[model samples]
Target: MTQYLAKYFALHRKLVLPGIGFFNTSTQPAQLEFVEKTLHAPVHTINFWQDENVADNNFISFLIKETGLNHYETINKFSQFITGLKEKLQSGVALKIPGLGILTNNENGYSFNPENLQQYFPGITAERVIRQNAQHSVRVGEDEKTSVEMHEMLNKEVVKDRWWIGAIVLAVVGVAAILYYYLSR
Candidate 1:
Protein backbone atom coordinates (compact mmCIF):
# COMPACT_ATOMS: atom_id res chain seq x y z
CA MET A 1 0.00 0.00 0.00
CA THR A 2 2.87 2.39 0.80
CA GLN A 3 4.52 1.67 -2.53
CA TYR A 4 1.26 2.13 -4.37
CA LEU A 5 0.69 5.52 -2.69
CA ALA A 6 4.28 6.57 -3.30
CA LYS A 7 3.97 5.79 -7.00
CA TYR A 8 0.74 7.72 -7.26
CA PHE A 9 2.28 10.69 -5.44
CA ALA A 10 5.35 10.62 -7.67
CA LEU A 11 3.26 10.67 -10.81
CA HIS A 12 0.64 13.18 -9.70
CA ARG A 13 2.86 15.28 -7.42
CA LYS A 14 -0.01 15.01 -4.93
CA LEU A 15 -1.24 12.30 -2.64
CA VAL A 16 -4.74 12.59 -4.06
CA LEU A 17 -6.36 14.21 -7.05
CA PRO A 18 -7.12 17.91 -6.49
CA GLY A 19 -10.89 17.93 -6.82
CA ILE A 20 -11.55 14.20 -6.61
CA GLY A 21 -9.85 13.46 -3.27
CA PHE A 22 -8.05 16.51 -1.91
CA PHE A 23 -7.85 17.64 1.68
CA ASN A 24 -10.26 20.34 2.81
CA THR A 25 -9.54 22.70 5.71
CA SER A 26 -12.29 24.86 7.19
CA THR A 27 -13.50 26.19 10.54
CA GLN A 28 -17.02 25.34 11.64
CA PRO A 29 -18.93 28.33 12.96
CA ALA A 30 -19.93 28.37 16.60
CA GLN A 31 -23.66 27.80 17.06
CA LEU A 32 -25.98 28.74 19.93
CA GLU A 33 -28.95 26.63 20.95
CA PHE A 34 -31.29 26.14 23.88
CA VAL A 35 -30.25 23.73 26.60
CA GLU A 36 -32.45 22.71 29.56
CA LYS A 37 -34.90 25.47 28.53
CA THR A 38 -32.08 28.07 28.65
CA LEU A 39 -30.07 29.61 25.82
CA HIS A 40 -26.60 28.05 25.64
CA ALA A 41 -23.61 30.09 24.50
CA PRO A 42 -21.92 29.19 21.23
CA VAL A 43 -18.41 27.71 21.05
CA HIS A 44 -16.09 27.30 18.06
CA THR A 45 -15.60 23.85 16.62
CA ILE A 46 -12.47 22.68 14.80
CA ASN A 47 -13.34 20.64 11.74
CA PHE A 48 -11.29 18.67 9.22
CA TRP A 49 -12.36 17.63 5.74
CA GLN A 50 -11.21 15.10 3.15
CA ASP A 51 -12.51 13.86 -0.18
CA GLU A 52 -14.94 10.95 -0.46
CA ASN A 53 -13.86 9.92 -3.96
CA VAL A 54 -11.12 7.65 -2.62
CA ALA A 55 -13.62 5.66 -0.58
CA ASP A 56 -16.22 5.80 -3.38
CA ASN A 57 -14.14 3.65 -5.74
CA ASN A 58 -14.67 -0.07 -5.39
CA PHE A 59 -11.77 -2.33 -4.39
CA ILE A 60 -11.75 -3.99 -7.79
CA SER A 61 -10.97 -0.76 -9.59
CA PHE A 62 -8.16 0.09 -7.19
CA LEU A 63 -6.62 -3.37 -7.63
CA ILE A 64 -6.89 -3.18 -11.39
CA LYS A 65 -5.19 0.21 -11.44
CA GLU A 66 -2.47 -0.51 -8.89
CA THR A 67 -1.73 -4.24 -9.20
CA GLY A 68 -3.15 -4.95 -12.65
CA LEU A 69 -5.05 -7.82 -10.98
CA ASN A 70 -8.28 -9.52 -12.09
CA HIS A 71 -11.67 -9.00 -10.36
CA TYR A 72 -11.52 -12.16 -8.19
CA GLU A 73 -7.96 -11.48 -7.13
CA THR A 74 -8.81 -7.89 -6.35
CA ILE A 75 -11.69 -8.84 -4.04
CA ASN A 76 -9.50 -11.34 -2.20
CA LYS A 77 -6.76 -8.75 -1.76
CA PHE A 78 -9.21 -6.14 -0.44
CA SER A 79 -10.68 -8.62 2.04
CA GLN A 80 -7.27 -9.43 3.45
CA PHE A 81 -6.40 -5.74 3.67
CA ILE A 82 -9.56 -5.03 5.66
CA THR A 83 -8.90 -7.94 8.02
CA GLY A 84 -5.39 -6.68 8.66
CA LEU A 85 -6.77 -3.24 9.46
CA LYS A 86 -9.17 -4.73 12.01
CA GLU A 87 -6.29 -6.56 13.65
CA LYS A 88 -4.33 -3.31 13.90
CA LEU A 89 -7.30 -1.66 15.59
CA GLN A 90 -7.44 -4.45 18.15
CA SER A 91 -3.86 -3.52 19.07
CA GLY A 92 -4.96 0.13 19.73
CA VAL A 93 -3.08 1.74 16.84
CA ALA A 94 -5.19 3.63 14.31
CA LEU A 95 -4.74 3.10 10.59
CA LYS A 96 -3.94 6.29 8.61
CA ILE A 97 -4.21 6.14 4.88
CA PRO A 98 -2.14 8.83 3.14
CA GLY A 99 -4.90 10.79 1.45
CA LEU A 100 -7.81 9.56 3.62
CA GLY A 101 -6.30 10.36 7.06
CA ILE A 102 -7.02 8.29 10.19
CA LEU A 103 -9.51 5.54 11.05
CA THR A 104 -9.84 5.14 14.78
CA ASN A 105 -12.21 3.85 17.43
CA ASN A 106 -14.74 6.31 18.73
CA GLU A 107 -15.04 7.24 22.41
CA ASN A 108 -16.71 3.87 23.03
CA GLY A 109 -13.94 1.99 21.18
CA TYR A 110 -16.61 0.02 19.33
CA SER A 111 -17.44 2.27 16.38
CA PHE A 112 -14.94 4.04 14.12
CA ASN A 113 -14.81 7.32 12.19
CA PRO A 114 -12.54 8.68 9.52
CA GLU A 115 -10.72 11.65 11.04
CA ASN A 116 -10.61 13.86 7.93
CA LEU A 117 -13.91 12.98 6.33
CA GLN A 118 -16.25 15.96 5.91
CA GLN A 119 -19.58 16.08 7.74
CA TYR A 120 -21.59 17.58 4.88
CA PHE A 121 -21.77 14.43 2.79
CA PRO A 122 -25.24 12.94 2.22
CA GLY A 123 -26.19 10.13 4.62
CA ILE A 124 -23.09 10.84 6.71
CA THR A 125 -23.48 11.67 10.39
CA ALA A 126 -20.53 13.22 12.23
CA GLU A 127 -20.85 13.33 15.99
CA ARG A 128 -18.32 14.88 18.36
CA VAL A 129 -17.83 12.98 21.62
CA ILE A 130 -15.95 14.35 24.61
CA ARG A 131 -13.56 12.16 26.60
CA GLN A 132 -12.44 12.86 30.16
CA ASN A 133 -8.96 12.31 31.52
CA ALA A 134 -7.55 11.97 35.03
CA GLN A 135 -7.44 15.14 37.10
CA HIS A 136 -4.24 16.47 38.72
CA SER A 137 -3.77 18.12 42.15
CA VAL A 138 -1.02 20.71 42.80
CA ARG A 139 0.60 21.43 46.22
CA VAL A 140 2.67 24.55 47.00
CA GLY A 141 4.12 24.09 50.48
CA GLU A 142 7.52 25.85 50.18
CA ASP A 143 6.17 28.47 47.77
CA GLU A 144 3.44 29.42 50.21
CA LYS A 145 5.99 29.79 53.01
CA THR A 146 8.10 32.20 50.91
CA SER A 147 5.02 34.28 50.02
CA VAL A 148 4.14 34.60 53.70
CA GLU A 149 7.66 35.79 54.48
CA MET A 150 7.38 38.48 51.76
CA HIS A 151 4.09 39.69 53.24
CA GLU A 152 5.70 40.06 56.67
CA MET A 153 8.55 42.15 55.18
CA LEU A 154 6.04 44.52 53.55
CA ASN A 155 4.20 44.91 56.86
CA LYS A 156 7.45 45.86 58.66
CA GLU A 157 8.15 48.58 56.04
CA VAL A 158 4.68 50.05 56.61
CA VAL A 159 5.26 50.13 60.39
CA LYS A 160 8.61 51.86 59.89
CA ASP A 161 6.92 54.60 57.80
CA ARG A 162 4.37 55.15 60.58
CA TRP A 163 7.16 55.60 63.18
CA TRP A 164 8.88 58.23 60.98
CA ILE A 165 5.61 60.17 60.70
CA GLY A 166 5.16 60.12 64.51
CA ALA A 167 8.73 61.43 65.05
CA ILE A 168 8.10 64.33 62.61
CA VAL A 169 4.91 65.30 64.47
CA LEU A 170 6.78 65.37 67.78
CA ALA A 171 9.52 67.61 66.34
CA VAL A 172 6.92 70.03 65.02
CA VAL A 173 5.24 70.25 68.50
CA GLY A 174 8.61 70.99 70.18
CA VAL A 175 9.29 73.85 67.71
CA ALA A 176 5.84 75.33 68.40
CA ALA A 177 6.44 75.24 72.20
CA ILE A 178 9.84 76.99 71.86
CA LEU A 179 8.32 79.73 69.70
CA TYR A 180 5.60 80.39 72.34
CA TYR A 181 8.22 80.44 75.20
CA TYR A 182 10.31 83.13 73.35
CA LEU A 183 7.21 85.30 72.73
CA SER A 184 6.21 85.09 76.45
CA ARG A 185 9.81 85.99 77.63
Candidate 2:
Protein backbone atom coordinates (compact mmCIF):
# COMPACT_ATOMS: atom_id res chain seq x y z
CA MET A 1 0.00 0.00 0.00
CA THR A 2 2.82 2.35 0.94
CA GLN A 3 4.77 1.52 -2.21
CA TYR A 4 1.65 2.09 -4.31
CA LEU A 5 1.00 5.44 -2.62
CA ALA A 6 4.64 6.45 -3.00
CA LYS A 7 4.58 5.58 -6.69
CA TYR A 8 1.21 7.27 -7.22
CA PHE A 9 2.55 10.42 -5.67
CA ALA A 10 5.81 10.10 -7.57
CA LEU A 11 3.92 9.92 -10.86
CA HIS A 12 0.98 12.25 -10.26
CA ARG A 13 2.80 14.45 -7.71
CA LYS A 14 -0.19 13.97 -5.40
CA LEU A 15 -2.00 11.13 -3.57
CA VAL A 16 -5.27 11.20 -1.66
CA LEU A 17 -4.88 8.87 1.34
CA PRO A 18 -8.18 7.25 2.31
CA GLY A 19 -9.61 8.38 5.69
CA ILE A 20 -6.73 10.84 5.99
CA GLY A 21 -6.60 13.54 3.29
CA PHE A 22 -4.95 14.53 0.02
CA PHE A 23 -1.25 15.19 -0.45
CA ASN A 24 -0.59 17.60 -3.32
CA THR A 25 2.46 19.16 -4.93
CA SER A 26 2.24 22.45 -6.77
CA THR A 27 4.49 25.26 -7.93
CA GLN A 28 4.27 29.03 -7.22
CA PRO A 29 5.31 31.86 -9.52
CA ALA A 30 8.55 33.63 -8.63
CA GLN A 31 8.69 37.17 -7.19
CA LEU A 32 7.84 39.93 -9.63
CA GLU A 33 10.57 42.17 -11.05
CA PHE A 34 9.89 45.94 -10.99
CA VAL A 35 11.99 46.96 -14.04
CA GLU A 36 13.15 44.31 -16.48
CA LYS A 37 15.66 45.22 -19.21
CA THR A 38 15.68 41.73 -20.79
CA LEU A 39 12.76 39.31 -21.28
CA HIS A 40 13.05 36.47 -18.75
CA ALA A 41 10.74 33.65 -17.72
CA PRO A 42 9.30 33.73 -14.17
CA VAL A 43 10.22 30.87 -11.76
CA HIS A 44 7.49 28.69 -10.28
CA THR A 45 7.17 26.75 -6.98
CA ILE A 46 5.08 23.70 -5.91
CA ASN A 47 2.32 23.39 -3.25
CA PHE A 48 -0.35 20.94 -1.82
CA TRP A 49 -3.85 20.85 -0.31
CA GLN A 50 -5.63 17.97 1.48
CA ASP A 51 -8.84 16.93 -0.28
CA GLU A 52 -11.32 15.70 2.33
CA ASN A 53 -13.91 14.67 -0.27
CA VAL A 54 -11.47 12.50 -2.17
CA ALA A 55 -10.29 10.84 1.05
CA ASP A 56 -13.90 10.14 2.10
CA ASN A 57 -14.81 8.69 -1.30
CA ASN A 58 -11.73 6.48 -1.38
CA PHE A 59 -12.56 5.19 2.10
CA ILE A 60 -16.15 4.35 1.12
CA SER A 61 -15.06 2.59 -2.09
CA PHE A 62 -12.42 0.57 -0.24
CA LEU A 63 -14.99 -0.68 2.26
CA ILE A 64 -17.45 -1.71 -0.48
CA LYS A 65 -14.84 -3.44 -2.66
CA GLU A 66 -12.80 -5.11 0.06
CA THR A 67 -15.74 -6.50 2.07
CA GLY A 68 -17.93 -7.20 -0.99
CA LEU A 69 -20.81 -5.54 0.81
CA ASN A 70 -23.71 -3.40 -0.31
CA HIS A 71 -23.43 0.36 -0.33
CA TYR A 72 -25.43 0.94 2.89
CA GLU A 73 -23.63 -1.74 4.89
CA THR A 74 -20.24 -0.64 3.61
CA ILE A 75 -21.03 2.98 4.39
CA ASN A 76 -22.10 2.18 7.96
CA LYS A 77 -18.99 0.10 8.57
CA PHE A 78 -16.72 2.69 7.04
CA SER A 79 -18.43 5.49 8.95
CA GLN A 80 -17.89 3.70 12.26
CA PHE A 81 -14.25 3.03 11.35
CA ILE A 82 -13.70 6.66 10.36
CA THR A 83 -15.42 7.92 13.53
CA GLY A 84 -13.22 5.71 15.70
CA LEU A 85 -10.05 6.80 13.91
CA LYS A 86 -11.07 10.48 14.12
CA GLU A 87 -11.79 10.11 17.83
CA LYS A 88 -8.37 8.54 18.38
CA LEU A 89 -6.62 11.28 16.40
CA GLN A 90 -8.61 14.02 18.18
CA SER A 91 -7.63 12.49 21.52
CA GLY A 92 -3.95 13.14 20.72
CA VAL A 93 -3.18 9.72 19.27
CA ALA A 94 -1.26 9.54 15.98
CA LEU A 95 -2.65 7.27 13.24
CA LYS A 96 0.23 5.98 11.13
CA ILE A 97 -0.98 4.79 7.75
CA PRO A 98 1.70 2.79 5.93
CA GLY A 99 3.13 4.47 2.78
CA LEU A 100 0.66 7.31 3.27
CA GLY A 101 1.73 9.26 6.34
CA ILE A 102 1.09 9.90 10.03
CA LEU A 103 -1.90 12.00 11.12
CA THR A 104 -1.15 13.84 14.34
CA ASN A 105 -2.39 16.89 16.22
CA ASN A 106 -0.17 19.88 16.78
CA GLU A 107 -0.81 22.89 19.04
CA ASN A 108 -2.31 24.83 16.16
CA GLY A 109 -4.06 22.04 14.21
CA TYR A 110 -3.65 18.59 12.62
CA SER A 111 -0.53 17.95 10.52
CA PHE A 112 0.57 15.14 8.24
CA ASN A 113 3.83 13.27 8.80
CA PRO A 114 4.75 12.17 5.28
CA GLU A 115 7.04 9.13 4.94
CA ASN A 116 8.61 10.51 1.76
CA LEU A 117 10.61 13.70 1.43
CA GLN A 118 8.53 16.89 1.25
CA GLN A 119 10.16 17.82 -2.04
CA TYR A 120 8.81 14.60 -3.59
CA PHE A 121 5.31 15.72 -2.56
CA PRO A 122 5.85 19.06 -4.41
CA GLY A 123 3.65 22.14 -3.67
CA ILE A 124 3.08 21.17 -0.01
CA THR A 125 4.22 24.23 1.90
CA ALA A 126 2.98 26.77 4.43
CA GLU A 127 -0.15 28.65 3.48
CA ARG A 128 0.08 32.32 2.57
CA VAL A 129 -3.23 33.32 4.12
CA ILE A 130 -4.01 32.07 7.64
CA ARG A 131 -7.64 31.12 8.14
CA GLN A 132 -9.16 31.05 11.62
CA ASN A 133 -12.47 30.08 13.22
CA ALA A 134 -15.03 32.88 13.49
CA GLN A 135 -15.91 31.94 17.06
CA HIS A 136 -12.31 32.24 18.20
CA SER A 137 -12.52 36.00 18.72
CA VAL A 138 -15.94 36.49 20.24
CA ARG A 139 -16.79 39.98 21.45
CA VAL A 140 -17.33 40.31 25.20
CA GLY A 141 -20.45 42.32 26.12
CA GLU A 142 -22.03 43.57 29.38
CA ASP A 143 -23.49 40.12 30.12
CA GLU A 144 -20.08 38.52 29.73
CA LYS A 145 -18.58 41.12 32.04
CA THR A 146 -21.28 40.35 34.62
CA SER A 147 -20.50 36.64 34.40
CA VAL A 148 -16.80 37.33 34.95
CA GLU A 149 -17.64 39.53 37.92
CA MET A 150 -19.82 36.78 39.36
CA HIS A 151 -16.93 34.34 39.08
CA GLU A 152 -14.69 36.82 40.90
CA MET A 153 -17.28 37.06 43.68
CA LEU A 154 -17.31 33.27 43.99
CA ASN A 155 -13.51 33.30 44.27
CA LYS A 156 -13.80 35.68 47.24
CA GLU A 157 -16.21 33.23 48.90
CA VAL A 158 -13.60 30.50 48.46
CA VAL A 159 -11.01 32.65 50.27
CA LYS A 160 -13.54 33.38 53.04
CA ASP A 161 -14.13 29.63 53.46
CA ARG A 162 -10.39 29.07 53.88
CA TRP A 163 -10.23 31.70 56.63
CA TRP A 164 -13.22 30.14 58.42
CA ILE A 165 -11.60 26.72 58.17
CA GLY A 166 -8.43 28.04 59.85
CA ALA A 167 -10.48 29.67 62.61
CA ILE A 168 -12.43 26.43 63.23
CA VAL A 169 -9.18 24.45 63.45
CA LEU A 170 -7.74 26.87 66.05
CA ALA A 171 -10.94 26.74 68.11
CA VAL A 172 -10.90 22.93 68.10
CA VAL A 173 -7.21 22.84 69.18
CA GLY A 174 -7.90 25.26 72.04
CA VAL A 175 -10.86 23.19 73.28
CA ALA A 176 -8.80 20.00 73.03
CA ALA A 177 -5.98 21.55 75.11
CA ILE A 178 -8.43 22.75 77.80
CA LEU A 179 -10.06 19.31 77.97
CA TYR A 180 -6.61 17.67 78.21
CA TYR A 181 -5.65 19.91 81.20
CA TYR A 182 -8.90 19.17 83.08
CA LEU A 183 -8.64 15.45 82.37
CA SER A 184 -4.96 15.35 83.41
CA ARG A 185 -5.75 17.12 86.72
Candidate 3:
Protein backbone atom coordinates (compact mmCIF):
# COMPACT_ATOMS: atom_id res chain seq x y z
CA MET A 1 0.00 0.00 0.00
CA THR A 2 2.89 2.34 0.81
CA GLN A 3 4.50 1.47 -2.51
CA TYR A 4 1.17 2.05 -4.25
CA LEU A 5 1.00 5.39 -2.46
CA ALA A 6 4.50 6.20 -3.69
CA LYS A 7 3.47 5.53 -7.28
CA TYR A 8 0.26 7.51 -6.80
CA PHE A 9 2.16 10.45 -5.35
CA ALA A 10 4.51 10.34 -8.33
CA LEU A 11 1.68 10.21 -10.89
CA HIS A 12 -1.51 11.59 -9.40
CA ARG A 13 -2.95 14.95 -8.41
CA LYS A 14 -3.38 14.36 -4.69
CA LEU A 15 -2.81 11.71 -2.03
CA VAL A 16 -5.01 11.07 0.98
CA LEU A 17 -3.73 8.88 3.73
CA PRO A 18 -7.06 8.57 5.48
CA GLY A 19 -6.69 9.56 9.17
CA ILE A 20 -3.10 10.70 8.59
CA GLY A 21 -3.01 13.86 6.47
CA PHE A 22 -3.60 15.10 2.96
CA PHE A 23 -0.83 15.96 0.48
CA ASN A 24 -1.16 18.33 -2.44
CA THR A 25 1.15 20.24 -4.74
CA SER A 26 1.39 24.02 -4.95
CA THR A 27 3.46 26.49 -6.89
CA GLN A 28 5.84 28.88 -5.20
CA PRO A 29 5.86 31.61 -7.77
CA ALA A 30 8.98 33.24 -9.15
CA GLN A 31 9.55 36.25 -6.98
CA LEU A 32 12.11 38.71 -5.71
CA GLU A 33 13.30 37.90 -2.23
CA PHE A 34 14.20 41.19 -0.57
CA VAL A 35 16.22 39.68 2.28
CA GLU A 36 18.03 37.15 0.06
CA LYS A 37 18.38 39.67 -2.78
CA THR A 38 17.73 37.03 -5.38
CA LEU A 39 15.02 36.45 -7.97
CA HIS A 40 14.00 32.81 -7.55
CA ALA A 41 12.43 30.87 -10.37
CA PRO A 42 8.99 29.37 -9.76
CA VAL A 43 9.04 25.97 -8.08
CA HIS A 44 6.51 23.22 -7.45
CA THR A 45 6.36 22.05 -3.86
CA ILE A 46 4.25 19.63 -1.86
CA ASN A 47 2.17 20.88 1.05
CA PHE A 48 0.78 18.84 3.91
CA TRP A 49 -2.79 19.74 4.73
CA GLN A 50 -3.83 18.72 8.25
CA ASP A 51 -7.22 17.23 7.59
CA GLU A 52 -9.57 14.63 9.01
CA ASN A 53 -10.09 11.12 7.58
CA VAL A 54 -12.57 12.75 5.18
CA ALA A 55 -11.99 11.95 1.50
CA ASP A 56 -10.57 14.34 -1.04
CA ASN A 57 -11.20 14.69 -4.79
CA ASN A 58 -8.38 12.57 -6.15
CA PHE A 59 -7.43 10.31 -3.26
CA ILE A 60 -9.80 7.40 -3.76
CA SER A 61 -9.68 7.47 -7.55
CA PHE A 62 -5.91 6.98 -7.59
CA LEU A 63 -6.17 4.33 -4.91
CA ILE A 64 -8.78 2.31 -6.88
CA LYS A 65 -6.50 2.05 -9.89
CA GLU A 66 -3.11 1.77 -8.17
CA THR A 67 -4.16 -0.83 -5.63
CA GLY A 68 -6.26 -2.72 -8.20
CA LEU A 69 -8.98 -2.99 -5.63
CA ASN A 70 -12.66 -2.12 -5.49
CA HIS A 71 -13.77 1.14 -3.85
CA TYR A 72 -14.61 -0.37 -0.48
CA GLU A 73 -11.50 -2.56 -0.39
CA THR A 74 -9.24 0.32 -1.41
CA ILE A 75 -10.74 2.54 1.24
CA ASN A 76 -10.21 -0.13 3.88
CA LYS A 77 -6.61 -0.71 2.83
CA PHE A 78 -5.97 3.03 2.69
CA SER A 79 -7.40 3.47 6.16
CA GLN A 80 -5.11 0.76 7.56
CA PHE A 81 -2.03 2.23 5.88
CA ILE A 82 -2.88 5.66 7.28
CA THR A 83 -3.34 4.27 10.80
CA GLY A 84 0.14 2.76 10.65
CA LEU A 85 1.72 5.90 9.24
CA LYS A 86 0.08 8.01 11.93
CA GLU A 87 1.31 5.69 14.64
CA LYS A 88 4.83 5.85 13.22
CA LEU A 89 4.71 9.65 13.01
CA GLN A 90 3.33 10.01 16.55
CA SER A 91 5.99 7.65 17.86
CA GLY A 92 8.67 10.05 16.51
CA VAL A 93 9.56 8.04 13.44
CA ALA A 94 10.30 10.08 10.33
CA LEU A 95 8.45 8.36 7.50
CA LYS A 96 10.34 9.02 4.29
CA ILE A 97 8.98 8.79 0.75
CA PRO A 98 11.23 9.24 -2.25
CA GLY A 99 10.70 12.48 -4.17
CA LEU A 100 8.30 13.48 -1.40
CA GLY A 101 9.69 13.93 2.11
CA ILE A 102 10.07 12.63 5.64
CA LEU A 103 7.01 13.26 7.81
CA THR A 104 7.29 13.95 11.50
CA ASN A 105 4.64 14.75 14.07
CA ASN A 106 5.40 16.61 17.24
CA GLU A 107 3.14 17.55 20.14
CA ASN A 108 2.09 20.77 18.50
CA GLY A 109 1.65 19.82 14.82
CA TYR A 110 2.49 17.38 12.03
CA SER A 111 4.99 18.44 9.39
CA PHE A 112 6.06 16.88 6.13
CA ASN A 113 9.85 16.81 6.19
CA PRO A 114 10.40 17.03 2.45
CA GLU A 115 13.90 16.06 1.35
CA ASN A 116 15.15 18.66 -1.15
CA LEU A 117 12.51 17.91 -3.80
CA GLN A 118 12.64 21.52 -4.97
CA GLN A 119 15.90 20.89 -6.86
CA TYR A 120 13.71 20.78 -9.93
CA PHE A 121 10.16 21.97 -10.54
CA PRO A 122 8.54 19.71 -13.17
CA GLY A 123 8.47 21.14 -16.74
CA ILE A 124 9.72 24.49 -15.50
CA THR A 125 13.42 25.29 -15.89
CA ALA A 126 13.56 29.04 -15.55
CA GLU A 127 17.13 30.18 -14.92
CA ARG A 128 17.58 32.03 -11.67
CA VAL A 129 18.15 35.60 -12.81
CA ILE A 130 20.84 37.33 -10.72
CA ARG A 131 22.23 40.80 -10.64
CA GLN A 132 25.97 41.34 -11.12
CA ASN A 133 25.65 44.70 -9.41
CA ALA A 134 24.33 43.42 -6.09
CA GLN A 135 23.98 46.84 -4.52
CA HIS A 136 21.16 48.92 -5.93
CA SER A 137 18.16 50.61 -4.38
CA VAL A 138 15.26 52.84 -5.38
CA ARG A 139 13.97 54.42 -2.19
CA VAL A 140 10.46 55.57 -3.02
CA GLY A 141 10.25 58.24 -0.35
CA GLU A 142 7.06 60.05 0.81
CA ASP A 143 7.98 63.03 -1.36
CA GLU A 144 8.09 60.99 -4.60
CA LYS A 145 5.10 58.75 -3.79
CA THR A 146 3.11 58.40 -0.60
CA SER A 147 2.36 55.02 0.97
CA VAL A 148 -1.31 55.48 0.09
CA GLU A 149 -0.40 55.86 -3.59
CA MET A 150 1.76 52.75 -3.48
CA HIS A 151 -1.08 50.83 -1.86
CA GLU A 152 -3.47 52.01 -4.52
CA MET A 153 -1.07 50.94 -7.24
CA LEU A 154 -0.78 47.51 -5.68
CA ASN A 155 -4.58 47.28 -5.43
CA LYS A 156 -4.91 48.13 -9.12
CA GLU A 157 -2.37 45.48 -10.01
CA VAL A 158 -4.32 42.96 -7.95
CA VAL A 159 -7.52 43.79 -9.79
CA LYS A 160 -5.74 43.54 -13.14
CA ASP A 161 -4.31 40.15 -12.19
CA ARG A 162 -7.72 38.92 -11.09
CA TRP A 163 -9.30 40.06 -14.34
CA TRP A 164 -6.66 38.22 -16.37
CA ILE A 165 -7.14 35.06 -14.31
CA GLY A 166 -10.91 35.24 -14.72
CA ALA A 167 -10.47 35.68 -18.47
CA ILE A 168 -8.21 32.66 -18.72
CA VAL A 169 -10.56 30.49 -16.68
CA LEU A 170 -13.54 31.50 -18.74
CA ALA A 171 -11.63 30.80 -21.93
CA VAL A 172 -10.73 27.32 -20.77
CA VAL A 173 -14.26 26.60 -19.58
CA GLY A 174 -15.69 27.89 -22.86
CA VAL A 175 -13.33 25.73 -24.88
CA ALA A 176 -14.15 22.67 -22.81
CA ALA A 177 -17.88 23.25 -23.28
CA ILE A 178 -17.48 23.69 -27.04
CA LEU A 179 -15.43 20.50 -27.32
CA TYR A 180 -18.01 18.61 -25.28
CA TYR A 181 -20.84 19.99 -27.41
CA TYR A 182 -19.21 19.05 -30.70
CA LEU A 183 -18.07 15.62 -29.51
CA SER A 184 -21.45 14.80 -28.04
CA ARG A 185 -23.10 15.91 -31.29
Clashing pairs in 3: none
Highest TM-score: give the candidate number: 3
- Give the better candidate number (1 or 3) by TM-score: 3
Model 3: how far residue 142 lies from native, Å: 49
lDDT of each: 0.50, 0.58, 0.72
List model 2 lDDT by residue over 1-185, tens digit each: 34444555656666564454667665444343435423223322223354456654654555466568999997776567667767888899997755456778667656876555433433323334555422233236543444445555567844234678889999999999999999999
- The CA lDDT at 143 in model 1 is 47
**Clashing pairs counted in every model:** 0, 11, 0
lDDT of 1 by residue, 1-185 (tens): 54664355434434432122333333454343424233223322222333434542433465478898887886677667656766776677776655435555445543324343334322323354454442334336554334445555557854234678889999999999999999999
- Give candidate 1 misplaced runs (Cα > 4 Å): 2-57, 106-185
- Model 1's lDDT to the true fold? 0.50
Question: Candidate 2 regions off by >4 Å?
Answer: 1-20, 24-59, 117-185
Which 10 successive residues of model 2 have the least lDDT summed?
Answer: 37-46
Give each model a TM-score: 0.31, 0.38, 0.52
